[model samples]
Target: MLAKVLEEPERGEFFARREDEAHSLVNLLQAILDYASLSPSLKRRFTSALIRLSSKSGRFPDCMVLEEVTRLGEDPVAAGSFGEVWKGSFYSEVIAMKVLKVYERSNVKELLKRFSAEIIIWRQLSHPNLIPFYGVYYLNASKTRICLISPWMQNGNVVQYLRREPDIERSYLMLDIARGLEYLHSGKPGIVHGDLKGENILITSSRRACLTDFGLASARDSELIMSSSTPNARVTGTLRWQAPELLNYEAENTRSTFASDVYSFGCVGYEIYSGEIPFHEVKSDYYVMQSVTRGARPPRPPLSLCQTRGLDDTLWAILQSCWLKDAAARPTAEYLVSRLRAMPRNAEEKTTPAAHGWDRLTRSRLSHSLVDHPLSCSAKVVQEWKQLSLFEDWEA
Candidate 1:
């Protein structure tokens, strides 16, 4: 089947099939099964072949990421106090390598515990959208370096994706991400992402996104989340997507509960619709938190626009529910996915003014990006997905 796909120049990259890919995969046998009926053994062979293909992505002492890794350096992407990230590869698969540098305050033992925990936790997580961990290595010395390997996305990150084209039907793509979240929330201990924002979400060659950088997923052991000693530490998350509860930094953020992630997802939803950072119009995280805490809801995606386009309100409601200030309020990611899938696909309006209901949010750059598209509206979902800043445009 893959050979057949290779026959077509467009589908030649058979190994790049992403479970959440925006486009159809023609090459793999399982993909063929998805396209047409096939025998079970054929599927087995396909899986075996893919494993071999995937294995080749990372292996060797002098791999690209390994060679490029340094004791102390600038972040290949960008830097925050959390850690310094680098772009690297394993086998041949591109990976975003992260190395947290040590400091005077760095507790070698505690730091190691947390860093090791990050890798160990990811080792057990496997989902289409939850980025997988290939391996980890440390340099010997007081330098105290910890490197984690994750699948690299040709595109940069989710925030950049929205900046270029915000009107795409990314809600479906979010469904895939939700599955990963559901898996995490359904685990034995039920992992808490601690941090969930656009920068941590990455896009694959196929334009499907995977959640990465789990350097802070530890769950809280707090009896009263609002009773933390250090209120300032709670502000560690990205300000743009700050959840209301994250404002107190210490006291209010006492518990890194599942609800906190939901709150973050709500802010992400806002980013998706507005094509701008959450609270970009705001002065500070504290101010944004005030609005969210007081139910200062970000304007909803225009119902007229949504209705005109036949967008799913149920799904939109699910996205909005994540914004609830009470950390105990949001639905589980699994439940949200279920509701989204059950939604009718009848609301696909083909023609309409781009500036109907979401006039304030949808403007020149965003609407213009979609106006000239030559593919199906669904095609635009991915058509523009690749065009987004995170990944190189694939139209060529």
Candidate 2:
């Protein structure tokens, strides 16, 4: 049956058959190893064959050879607990390669399993606001150095980009993130972005914001809580952006909900507006966690600062609602998107009439002054001043 399926020209059928064969082969090997001991030579040969077949089974069809990738830097573009991200060139296109760190030999199997899972999740997601996954590749025959590839964002992460262009409008950035979260939450079972922070939001070459780093993400129905006994399963999200409920022992059994994500979104909004990490003054993660659980909120940026950036009271109110103590009280990602969508229109409406009225009043006063101050100046000079005022008004 496998041979016949492989002979078929249809790509879908071929892949389906390959997947079935791979699973059957794995089960057979496990059974043979456990209940029937084979000669070491025979077992090794079988394992090697299985590995070779699996590599070409189209699981990650876009997987590239080591020769296809060229590293552009000695140092990684970003680094964290899981791995290092390096900028590289793949087929003439700049790509970000995330290389997972290999630890002890005993843990390699588990790490590879996790890496495969991440790949599967990325394949399932498709959104403009989410980072685009290109393919996966191994650096050596040992398969020890696995790298996940994606398009590299030239502008870097949100925090870095904002620092460089402090005057850039952030409403669109916040809206992009909210749209990504909404898409994740709207999936069949819904995906919770367990880690949502400014660092995870990348700025694209087109100046659009995209969400990345899904190492901690999980389906809402199967959310896992970090336990002391399972250090590997511990929550990897940053303390500052974590929801208060995530810090409570009693809530461990409770799955992370859409509300928790909303809480994190609020923190990200603060970071985007203030150009500072949430709880920037806090010295330690533990302290930040404690303060969050105790209901201590980050201080609001001064109204003058917010106003200067076109952020008004209505937007601030939305941010406040996001951090409400009761998760149920927090607005949904969809709702936030709608509010953000209407914000620019709201600003325009509020300012348009007032600005027009002020302009009209100024022109009326100037016209009256020109009439009353008749021959105090030469007629040619007055006519020139009148033409200049008209030109300025027209330009405005």
Candidate 1, which segments miss by more than 4 Å at Cα? Answer: 1-75, 104-107, 139-143, 164-168, 219-235, 239-242, 248-253, 301-312, 345-396
Instruction: Give the least accurate 10-residue stretch of model 1, judged by summed lDDT.
Output: 56-65
Per-residue accuracy of model 1 over 187-228 as CA lDDT, tens digit each: 643566767877788765555667777766642222211121
Clashing pairs in 2: none
Evaluate residue 260 in candidate 2 and report its C-alpha lDDT on the 0 to 100 scale.
Answer: 84
Q: lDDT: which candidate is best?
A: 2
User: What clash count goes with each model?
Assistant: 13, 0
**Each candidate's lDDT (Cα)?**
0.52, 0.64
As a TM-score, model 2 comes out at 0.69
